[model samples]
Every structure is written in C-alpha cells, then in structure tokens.
Target: MKRRTKKLLLNWRIILLTVFLIGSVVTLAVRPLTFGIDISGGVALVAQTEHPVDADTMQLVVDSLQKRLNTLGLRDITVEAQGDQIVLVKVANVTTAEEADAIKNVIESQGVFYMEFDGVIFGTGQDVEYVGIYQIKPDNTWSVPFRISKSAAEKFAELAKGKTGWPVDMFLDPPVNSLLVVPDSVYNLMNSSEFNAQVPEAPTLLQRITKAFNITVVAYANQTADELADMAEGREKIVLVDLNQGLQSELENMNVTVRLVQRGPGESDHALIIRTLGLYGPYSVGEGLATGQPQQDVQITGTASDRLTAEQEARQIYTVLKSGSLPVKLNVVGMEFISPRLGENFKYQALLAGIGALIAVFAIVYFHYRNWKIAIPVASTSFFEAIIILGFAALIQWNLDLPSIAGIIAAIGTGVDQQIVITDELLGGTKETRITRRSNVLKRMGRAFFVIFASAATTIVAMSFLLIYFVGTLKGFAFTTILGVVIGILVTRPAYAEIAKYLLGED
Candidate 1:
C-alpha cells in the first residue's frame, strides 16, 4: 500500500494537476480576474451605422473603435461588431453621463473630415498633419495648431485671395454641423483668458459647454437668430434661449455663450431640419473665423477661465485630432447604464451559483458511486478545473461578464459528466473483467478518454463557430466554455483517470 501510494503521488498526471492548482491559487491571490460591465457596473451602448456595411468593414470599424477606447485609458472595454451594420460597445467602470458621452463620440465619428469654403471642398481632416498645443507667445493665451498639407495651404491661399476675412469652415465628416464637441477636461482648459487671448478670432470658443455639449443662451427678451448657422449638426440645436442677460454673461465668464436673438424658435419644420442638420448640409463652423492663406499652419483657440481647465481641454482635443476617424457614420440607438452597487450584487449571486453547482454535482456523484474514493477525486477535479479556467482568464486579463459566468457553469456540468464516465468505466466491470491487471485498467481508461475526447472536441468546434461568427456579448460565453473544456481534457481529466486507477487497483 505504501509503494502504491508513493507511485500514485509520483504519477505525471498528478504532478501536473498539482502544479496548475498551485499556480491558479497564486494567480487569483496576486492578480484577480477583471470584471466586465455586467459585473462591474458601467455602460453598454448599441450603435447602428448610418448606412449598411459589409461584415469585414464592420469588423474593421469595431477594431478601430477598440483602439480609440484603449487610448482613453479604458482597458475594460469591448467593441464588437453585431450583425453587419450594428456595433456594440461595453465600457466597464464608467458610471457618469460625461464618461458615457465621451465613449459615444469615439464610437460614432465617421471620420470623414473636410474643410470647405462657400460649399466647395478644399481640404479635409486628412489635410491636417497634426493637432497639438501651440505656445504662441507664452504667458498669453495658447492655441491649437493644425499643420495642413502644402496643397491645402495653397488652396486656402488661392481661395482667400479674393475672399480674405471670409469664413473658411473646418469640419469633421463634412456636411455635419461643427459644434466643437470636446471632453470636459478640454472644455475647462479653453475657458482660460490666457488661452483665449492667443486665438482672438474665435469669439465662440469660450461658450458654456456642459458635459461636452453646446449650450447657447439667449437674452430674457426671447427671440432666436435668423438662422444659427452651426445649428445643423447631429441632433436638433438645444439652445438656452430663455435666460436673462446677466445669467448669460455669467455663463460666458465660465466660457459659456449667451447671445441676442431677434426671431422666435422658428417654424416646427425648421426645428426638425436643424435636428438632422439637413441630413447632408454643409456644416457651419463655430464663430466663423476668417482665414489668411495660412501657409500650412492654422490656429484654433478657445477661452478657459483658468490654467488647469485650459490644459485639460487641449489634451482632450489633441486625442480627438490624433485618433483616426470611423469608417461609417453611426447613431446611438441604445444605451444602458449599470450602477456599481448593482454590479456588486451580481458578483455575489454568481459566486453563490458557482458554489451551489459544485455542491450539487458532488452530492449527485457521491450518491451514484457510493464510494468516497471515487467521488472525492472526481469532485476535487471538477473544483480544480474551475480554478484553472478562472486563473487562465485572470492571467489573460479577460473581463468576467455575466455570460462568462454562465459559461463556467456549463463547463462544470460537462466536466462532472465526463468524470462520471471515467469512474463507471473503471469500477463497474463484472468479476470476469474487474480486479484486473494494471495493463487492463489502462485499456479501460483509454476507452473512457476516447468518449471524453470526442465530447470535448465537438463542444470546442461548436463554440468556435459562436466565437467567430457571433461576435458580440456571446463571445464571453464561448471563450470561457472553450477554455474550460481545453483545461479539463488536457489537465484535469487525465489526473482524474490516474487517481481512479490507483484506487481501483488497490481494491
């Protein structure tokens, strides 16, 4: 018995399982698995492309969006293509409206940049070489310098020859309104007097922007402009046209805008037209700055009330300018926010479900076998299999969403079934076939593994399809399931067979 125990302990299968078990525990202790939005409480948005795109193009868009989100330091984000035209984005740990909006902008930008004069395109965002902070006469206001291509510069010069001081509008994804969509950090930076001093031509730079939105204030004696040129953007222009002059000035002091108006809100149809920005109208530039033939250098300026605000605003704009644009235009069709507290509740529930599954599987297996020797090892292997799967996920930094939790449960079920097959093959033979030689036991175990291997292979194949073809939230489920099966077959199952053989040999 002592020799047998020593041999079993020294078995290669046992040694491998032991190593993985230890490593799994250590990994869990050191770097725990990262939770997804469903578990950590964040936001999930579904966007539909403005026009239909092929699957490959959709995939490219998704990949590009993922890259953009990562640059924002948001590591826990999933950008997947759903069908051919819908994109799904999940951002973990973002609870604020401001954060959600920032992500939305990154996902929806069509990236079709253009600079036009009097409705004629002369340049696009592509013409701009770089967008960065420009120290124009330091200690005064700062400006954002856009270095354009020589061709763009010459074209602008030619256009400006006769139309000097005429508005030369710069646009992103032309025909879309330009409202200077900036992040909160950047909006604060542009409010500074120092920054505004440098770009004196941009009168609308310091307008009160709340949560990266345009807020236009009108005097107490209410009336709307003949046509707020920049009103033709993504959605209807939401102007604060009812406020008094004093409040308007206060908001402007904080870098907000309050202007005088002479007409009422205008016709209802006009309101709808502004909502869609004519769907395909030339986008109006804010504060319509006049341009000289800027020889490859263009400065954009905005006012920030303080220094930190100016810096943050500049950083935000810099990121937008640096990142590549989206391929197709998209509109936010759905958005849902999950609070952290609710996510915490989900974590607890998942834990309880997993524990309950383990207990239930063990009870059933023990009752079926009526032997601790067989039941204990089988149950132990199942438990260790889960740890291995979780460890792998953590090591890879995979986000643990609700679907992933469900996958873990499915894998546990399959593992228990496989273990039962192994035990039955080893112990249920008749006297003529049972109490056999070590060679015979090896043959029986091989037969059991054959069945296990086939089942595992089929499962993996099915999951592969889901992972490849269905690439949205379902990906989490398929990924965890495959990981569980591979670990079970390669790592845990072999160890279980070895332990069963040792115990059965003794009997």
Candidate 2:
C-alpha cells in the first residue's frame, strides 16, 4: 500500500487531473455558471441573417446589435454569434410579451444609413470606409471622425460645392414603409413645444416626421379599424403606441407586422424619433468640407455637461459608426420568454434532480464493485467530472439551461461506465491473481484507455455537429456535453486508470 501510494502520486495522469481539479475550483470561485432564461428567467432570441456571412461579419453583427441596445440604455444583454449567419441574444429581467416584441423589432430594424443634402441622398452606409478614434477636447466636448470612400467623398463635394453652412442631415436605420399609430394623449405630447424644442431649428414634430421620414403619423382615435387596416395595406411594419385589439387583429389578418412601443412619462420627442426613426444629426456643412474638395475625413462634434457624459457621447457614436455600416440584415428566427417565478421553480427542480441522480449513481457503482476503495474512487471521479465541466462553463460564461444539465448527467454516467472498464481490466476477473505482472497490467491499462478514447471521440463528433448547426438551447447542450467528454478522456479516465492499477497491488 505504501509503495502503491507513491506510484499513484508519481503518476502523470493523476497529476493532470489534480491540476485540472484545482484550476476548475478556482474558476468556479471567480466566475460562477451563468444560467439561461429557462433557469434564471428572461428572454432568449435567435436572429438569422438573410444570407450566410463570414466570421468577421457575424461578429460585427453581434457587436452592432449590442451597441444599438446599449445606446438605448439597455445594458443587461448578451449577444453571441452562432454558425456563420445566426446570432443569439439573451436579455435579463424581461417579463412581458410586449417587451419581447419591442426587442424583436429593434433587432430586426438594422437599416441603411444615409446622409442627405437638401433632401438628396449623397452618401450611405456603403460609402463609409473607416471610423477614427473618438477624441475629447480640453473642454467637455467630444468628436468622432470617419472617412468615406473616394467616390462617395467626390459625390458629396459635388452635391454641396457652394452650399456652406447648410445642415447636412444624417439618418441611420430609418423606418422605410412604416407607420406610427398613437393615442390622442401621445399625439398631443408630440405636438407640444417641449417636444419640438428637442431639435434645434427644426419645424413642428408632426411636420418634420411626415416630411423628412415619410412616416404617416395617424391618431388611432381619428381612424376606424377598417380605415387603419386599409392604410396598412402596403406598409411593412406598424408601430403602435397604445394597444388596440381591433386594429391589431385587422393588421394581423392582413399579414402585416405590428409592434408595440411603450409610452413612458417624460419621454422626449427627440428620443421618440430616435426610437422610431433612427435619425442621428443635422451636421452643419463647414466651408472646407462643402468647398467641392473631395474630402474623405469628417467628424461628428458635440458638447456634454461633464467628462463622463462627453466620453459616453463619443463612444456611442464611435460604436455606431464602426458597426452600423454592415450591409447584412437579420430576421427573427425564434423567440422564447421565461417568467422569473417559473424559472426559479425550474432551477430548484434541477438542483434536486441533479442531487438525486448523483446519489443513485454512487449506490449502483458501490453495489457493482463491493469494494470501498474502487467504489469511492469511481463515485468521486464522477463528482469531479461534474465540477470540471461546470468550471469550464463558468470560465467562458456559457449559459446553462435544461438541455445543458441533461448533457452533464449523460457525460458523468458515461464516465462511471468507463471507470468500471478500467477496474475490471486491472482485476482480470476471478481467475486472475491479485498481483498481476507489471507488463500485463500495463497492456490492460493501454487497452482500457483505447476504449475510453474511442468512446469519447464518437460522442465529441456527434456533439460538434449539434453545436455548429443549432442555436439557442441546443448549443448550450452540445457545448457542455462536448466539454465533459473531452475532460473525461484527457483528465479523469487516465487518472482513474492510474489509481486502479495502484489499488490492484501493482507498482
């Protein structure tokens, strides 16, 4: 036993698992498992591009969506790219179907950016080549510079050759072929002075929205369901402020997309426009830029009350300019909402179920072995397998849903079966002696390892397909399952082999 303990300690396989176990414990302590909507309660959305995109473009899509929401003061969201064309978004603390619908609209509305000079389209998002770093002056003013393509710059110069000091308007993610339906109260608020005061030198809110954006703003009270539904005949989307079941049903029957926009107290007209229309600025054409010089460099300048505000302003514009120029568009492929109360109940049930499964595993393994040394090691290996799998998830911040938990259990069960193989191989049945020859024991361990590797490879291959082809909950399942199989093959199985060999009275 003393010699066997030394051999076990000196084993390279044992050392590998021990190191991983310690690292996994540290990882868990630092970053715990991030639970999915099914467990922690929120919204899960899958958005897919119209056509497949490269890895870089897919990442840009994710970043663009994240920044767009962050600009709207939504920070508790995760955007992840799946495959080459799909994106997964998880938003926390969302409970209502209305909020989910609003979010879905926002993600789907990434549109082309256009800069117009006197109502003529001079440049679009396609013209932008690069966005420079944001700069802050000694004062609390910030600027974000960008460069356009040579052709686009030349075209802009021709459009504004002598039109100095003109307001060259910038519009991003504009609502094309869309309508806004609002109640009398909200419509009156939009017509108020405070609302129009948000935009400098701009006309009335109603006039500017109608003229500049071509969006028909109709008071729902003024139009009957038949009239509204007829008006929406050629429209792509209808943004409704207050919920009206009759109009919604009519529009739905027409196969039109109707989205809800919540009206909050103290909502400014400019903010409402930004939310509904995505207009950015009315940048003044300087003498230099408007002199027909074909200039490529341009900057967006603004003043903020403090350094923090200035930084925020500059960063937001920088992020938008960098990411919003991507030409691809995403459509909502799937959506799921889990209420907080239901998620909590599911979480408790998962915990209880995991514990019960673990207990049963130990009992079955102990009954089969009838040896404390073998049984203890087998059960402990399964337990450690779970910890290490969770640790990997925590390290990368993977969201664990029901499917992920099931994958973990399946991996652990496979681990126990493999461990039993190693034990039986070492013992060589009842006909064999306790102290088998060293060379024979080595051969048996090699065979056991080969079997373990083969099993793990098959599992990993099947899971890799699922991980690449699927999005949302299934990705979580594939990821955790693959990680478990890999850890078992590389760390736990070989380590268990070493321990079992030592226990069989081999040096």
Candidate 3:
C-alpha cells in the first residue's frame, strides 16, 4: 500500500479503535442486562372487566396503577393490557404474599378521595355563623368550629345564651370529636333562664340545635365533574360523614341495618343508602344503587377467613364490587407459569444456540470476503451491536426474556447483512470516473440506509402496537426488538460503513 493509503487507513483505524475503546468502557461500566420476572419470581394477576374496554381507557387505568405502584416504591413493575378486556400486572421483589395482595386490593379500590380543610373559627357568644372541619394535613388531622347559618344565628345565640365558654364536641361522624371549641364568656350564659331550662335537656337539645346548623362544604370521592353533574339533577341533598375509629368499631359490631322507604324512577338499581355509620364513613350509600326504596336491614355478610391469603383475596373482591364495575369484563383464558429451574435451563440452551449461530455467521463472512481484514471489522461490528443492545437493556432496566434474546439475535443478523452491503459497494467500483465511483458508493449506501430505516420504522410500529395492545412476554420481545433495531440503524451500521470505506481506499 502507498504511504498516503497507509496514512488514511491509520487514521480510520484510530477512529474505529477509539470508538471500540469507548464502547468497551461504556459496556463494562454500564453492564446493562435486565433480569426478567421469570428468573425472579413475582406476582401476576389478570383482571377482566365486564364490558368491552378500549385501549385508551385501559391505558389510563394502567397509568394510575403505575403511579400507585411507584408510590409504594415497588421496582420492576409492569402493568399492561393483554387484550381489549383483560389487564395483566407483574411486580418484582415482592417481599411478602401480603404485598401482592395489597396491590390487588388497591387496584380493586379504584375510587380514591383526598381532602384538605381551610380554616375554622370558634362560635361567638351571640351566635355560631358556620360550623365545619378543615383538614390540616394529608393524614386527616382537622380543625373544627361551631358554625350556624345567618338565618339560624339567632336561634344559636338563644341556645348558647348562658352556655358561653361551654365546650361542644364537633362530631365528624359518631364518637369522632374532631375538636372542641368553647365560647369566650361563661357568666352571662350561666345566669340566663334559658341556660337552666335547657340544662336538663342539653344533650338532646344540643343535638337538635346542631342538626339545624347549615354549613357549606365541598366533598369529592374521585367522581368526575361530569359524572357528578349528571347525578346532581333532581338528586335530593344528602349528608356524608367520615367516621372515627371508635364509631367504626361500634357500627361494625352492631346489628344495625339500613332499608330504603321508596325508589325513584331515575334511581340506579344497585343503590342501597344506609343511615348507619361504618368503618370509613357515616350514612354510607352503595354506589350505582337505586334510591328511595323501603328501608330494610343490612347485615354485614363479610367474615374474616382463617387463611390470610383467602381473607385478602376476599377483601379485594369486595373492593372491586363496591367500586363501580369494570368497563370491560375479562376472562383469563390462558395462563402459563414457567418455573425458575426451567427458565435457567432455557437460558443456558439459548446461550449455546446463540454462540453457535454467531460463530457460523462469522465463518461464512470470512470465506465470502476472502480477506481477514474485512472479516474482522464485520465480526467486530456484529458483536459490538449485540453487546451495546444488551448494555442498553440493562441500563434501562428492560426485562430480558427468551423473546428479547431472539430479538437481539435477529438484530445481529440484520447488522451483518448491512455490513456486507457496504463491503460489496466498496469492492464493485463500477462507476467510470473516481468521483462517480465515490458518488455511486454513497448512493448505494443511501439506498441501503433508506431500506434499513424503512424496515426499522415498520418494526417499531408493529412493536408499539404489541406493547400497547398485548401483555407479558410478547411485550418484552417487542420492546427489545425495537430498541435493538433503532440502535443498530442509528449507531452501529453507520460506524461499520465508515470503517468499510476507509478499508477499501474509498476515502
């Protein structure tokens, strides 16, 4: 080779060498290889709704679920829709069976309500203007005040006339005294005749007086504004209350039941309004149920099972039923669980098979090129592509299942083919002039790039659909395949082409 050609080759070699060194460092430092759930056993649940659910709706649910799972600090969690009606959830590093069950329970409890209070003021000696409790924190700490409507302020003053400085409990539900606010004056209220007359009947009278106090309040239970608006028309005003722990225990243990006296034509069939206080709330009404029916006793049919797993599952079922039903019903028509032992065995076999295929391809390229110089670059580029793909998989925490392995193998084959195309263009030199020759090589490579880009685009589209519409291992395959093809086209293939041009004295 001429000195100039040697210089060019040296320069190109240095560039390739630098890329190889940096790629090696990145590969070693990053060590991106993801472990799938199959190797690390985790929980998998398949839920199906009753109605047909579209992808958009399912995606929303999955996004909400992802947020909840993240809040719980769970790792390697995957939630996706399998079909139109079914959703699949997989979580890794689950410490206990109860954790899995709790996840299921949370998913079942789709309605989440959060509230915050603004401010509270004590009742004056004259009258209480408005009574309400404000939440001070996310944990439900509250401040309460004795409030009376402007119209009823006079009656409040009469009831509290001589009882100034007396402490009155602000009941959130029953037995839950949120706070106690006392009037400023006591002597003026104690000397009044109204104080003595109401002293004996104070408790009962106080209850009646408090009941008449009207306060403006805002409440939300995760129902959308549109849903609330639709339900608000012709809906009778109802008071909802949150119960304290003591009140919840009392209600749970009591034999109290609720019955409706009448049913309205517009009422839902599943509605069952209760007057009794329960664990989470007072005067709880079952959602999606009809209203205005004759009142009947309600027996808490739930029983604690001896087995914790069974009890937890039951609670999940109850939550799902209580929350509105799913838009689409799903049936787990098929499920397959591969044991860790099997996974290990398959992995070993897959490793051997991949090595064998790679060796065979490298040997064929060496014979076809008849030049060790060309074969080395081709083999190195192919190996580099595979390593980079795996490194990325590990870095991004992608699950590497059998299907993902297959994708990497396919990417390697495609990469080798691309390298061969570059080699052929460099060797042919069919153009009459030197510039024409160079232009021809570039045009050929450009066409090759277009074909590769188009192929990658199609694969991405297909994989995206699979990821969006399917679940489990298939999604793993699609994800890895897309990643591999994108990286091979954008990075490895271009680098290989540059190396080939310098080797063939085209530059």
Whole-model lDDT values for every prediction = 0.65, 0.76, 0.50
Residues 291-321, model 1: lDDT tens digits: 4444776665555667777775554444344
| Candidate 3 lDDT, 1-507, residue by residue in tens | 586556655665446545754775586585645566666556677766567677766765665555445434356778877666677877754545556666776566543311101112222212322223222333332222233335333333333344423323221111122111112122122223232221343432123222323321223344433433333333332222321233323322442211112322243212211111111111112221123222222111223334454444333323322222234333443333445666677778878877886787779988886777788888888777777777667666677878888888877887787677667766763333332376877887787787778877887898899776666787777777787787777777777777777676665
lDDT of 3 at 263: 26
Better of 2 and 3 by lDDT: 2
| Residue runs of model 3 more than 4 Å from their true location after superposition | 1-32, 54-56, 94-99, 109-112, 118-342, 429-471
At residue 60, give the lDDT of candidate 1. Answer: 57
Error of 3 at 378 (Å): 1.4
Off by over 4 Å in 2: 45-67, 70-89, 96-102, 111-336, 430-435
Query: Any idea what lDDT model 1 has?
Result: 0.65
How many steric overlaps does candidate 2 have? 0
Candidate 2 lDDT by residue in tens digits, 1-507: 676688779888888899899999999997767787777788989999999998767866886787566444342578888788888888876788977887898799875677766556677877889888899988999899999888878888998787766556666666656688877765775555433323344344555556656667777765766677677677777777655556666766777787655443356645665565555655667778767889898888889999999998887677667665766888999998878899889888988887887788778877876777788888888889999998888887777889999899888888988898888878775425464588888887888889888988899999999898766667778887888889998899888877776665654
- Which candidate do you rate higher for TM-score, 1 or 3? 1
Which one wins on TM-score?
1
TM-score of model 2 (CA atoms): 0.58
After TM-score superposition, the amount by which residue 235's alpha carbon in candidate 3 deviates from its true location, in angstroms, is 39
Error of 1 at 137 (Å): 48
